[model samples]
Each structure stands twice: as structure tokens, then as C-alpha cells.
Target: MALIITDECINCDVCEPECPNSAITQGEEIYEIAPDRCTECVGHYDEPQCVAVCPVDCIPKDPDHVEDEEQLMVKYDKLQAE
Candidate 1:
């Protein structure tokens, strides 16, 4: 699943640079992750980079877009292709 930043985000700007897919961006108030671009770091790392860097622990699995490991890999491949 793609990770999402909750309203609890402090907008510290730490997670943006850590994202390998460049999926995180500054929203109106908090940072947002593009679900289509988010592969949960499957292609690049063992774990989600954003989650690792986020101080507030606001980033969490996107319950609305759950996917298995194979699906995540496919998404990662598509992202790299683009």
C-alpha cells in the first residue's frame, strides 16, 4: 500500500528528501503522497523511506489502497519506466 501523511504531520520537511520515488510533496498545509507514484520503497529500499525519516510518525499505510508485495513491485517498475 501507498503511505499517507496524516493531519498530525508537523510539516518539518524531513520526509520529502528521503522519498526515493519523489512521491512526497508539500500540500496546502501538510505533505502529501501521490498514491500512483508511491511504491512503499519496494523497488529501492527494504522499507518506506518517508516513514523512516518522519519525526511525527504521521506517515502510515494507506488503508484505502492496499496491495500485496507483487503489486507493489509492479507499481515500482511502472514508476521506473516513466
Candidate 2:
């Protein structure tokens, strides 16, 4: 599943750079995750880097964007393709 930043986000900017897919971005107030670009770090790491670094644990899985591991891997490859 794609991860989402909740309203609990502090906008501290800590989780933005930790995302391997560059899926996280600064929003008007809280940070937002681009679901289309988010692969949950499937091809880059064992776990989601943004969730690992977030101090408030505001990142949570988006139930609306659920996807399988194979789908995530394919998204990751597409993101890194040149």
C-alpha cells in the first residue's frame, strides 16, 4: 500500500529527504505523499524510509491505494528507469 502523511505531521521536513522514491513533498501545511510515485521503498530498502524517520509516526498506509508487492516492484523500476 502507499503511505500517507496524516494531519499529525509537524511539517518538520525530517521525512522528506528520507524517501528513496522522492514520493514525499512539502504541502501547504503538512507534508504529502505522492501515491503514484510511492513504492514503499520496495526496490530500495526493506522498509519505508520516511516512516522510519518520522518523529510523530504520522505516516500510515493508504487503504484506498492498496497494491501488491509485485505492483510496487514494477512501480519502483519504472521510477528508476532512464
Candidate 3:
């Protein structure tokens, strides 16, 4: 599943660089995670780096972009190819 940065995000600036897919970015109000680019670090790490580093523990699986591990890997591969 793609991970989401919730409203609880502290905007501590830790999660952005932790995203291997470069999917996290600053929004108008707070940080945001792009569902299309989020892979939960499927190909980059054993767990989501952003989640690991977030002090607020605001990153959670996105219900709107749920996908299995295989699907996430496929997305990772496609992203890597690009």
C-alpha cells in the first residue's frame, strides 16, 4: 500500500529525503505524499524510510491507494526504469 502523510505531520523535514521514490514533498500547508509515486519503499528498503524517520508517526498506509506487495514491486520496477 502507498503511504500517506497525515495532518499530524510535524513538517519536521525528515520524511522528504527519506522517500527513495522522491514522492514526498511540501504542500501549501504541510508535507504531502504522492500516491502515484509511493511504493512503500518496496524496492529500496525493508520498510518505508519515511515512516521510520517521521518523529510524529504520521505516515500510514493509504486506503485510497491500496496495493499488494507484488503490485508495489511492479511500480518500483517501472519507476526504476524511468
Candidate 4:
């Protein structure tokens, strides 16, 4: 599934650089993840780098944009080609 940054985000600025897809961005209130670009690190790593580095543990799977591992991999491959 794609990830979403909750309101709990402290805007620490660490998560942005960790995203391989460059999907995370600063929003009006907090960081936002673009679902189109988020593949949960399927092609890059075993775990999501942003989740690993976020001290607040505010990053979570986007239920509204859910996708299985295989689907995520496809998205990752598409991103790599761009």
C-alpha cells in the first residue's frame, strides 16, 4: 500500500529525503505522499525507508490507496522507467 503522513507528523524533514520515489512533499500542514508515486519501497528495499527513519511513527499505510506487494512492484517498475 502507499503510505500517508498523518497530522501527527512533526515536519522534522527527515522523511522527504528517504523516499526513493520522491513521493513525499511538504504540504500546508505536514508532509504528503503522492499515491501515484508511492510504491512502499517495493523495488528498492525490503522496508519503507521513511517509516524506518520517522521518529514519530506517524507514517502509515494508506487504506484508501491500498495495494498488494505485486501491485506495488509494478508501480515501482513504472516509476523506474520514468
- In angstroms, give how far residue 72 of model 1 lies from its true place: 0.7
Instruction: Give one digit per residue, the lDDT tens place, for model 3 in 1-82.
Output: 8988889987899989888999999998889989889999999999999989988899989999989999999999999999
lDDT of 1 by residue, 1-82 (tens): 8899999999899999998899999999999999988999998999998988888899889999898989999999998888
Clashes of 3: 0
Pairs that clash in candidate 3 = none
- TM-score of every candidate relative to the true structure: 0.96, 0.96, 0.97, 0.98
Clashing pairs in 1: none
| Model 2: residues with Cα > 4 Å off, grouped in runs | none
lDDT of 2 by residue, 2-72 (tens): 99999999998899899888899999988999999999999988999999999999999999999999999
Instruction: Compare the candidates by lDDT and give the number of the best one.
Output: 4
Weakest lDDT window of 10 consecutive positions for candidate 3: 2-11
Candidate 1 has an lDDT of 0.92
lDDT of each residue in 1-82, candidate 4, tens digit only: 8999999999999999999999999999999999999999999999999999999999999999989999999999899999
* Candidate 4: residue 24 lDDT (0-100): 97
Best model number under TM-score:
4
Local distance difference test scores for all models: 0.92, 0.93, 0.92, 0.96
Query: Considering lDDT, which of the candidate structures 2 and 3 is the better prediction for this target?
Result: 2
What is the Cα root-mean-square deviation between model 4 and the actual structure? 0.5
Worst 10 residues of 4 by lDDT: 73-82
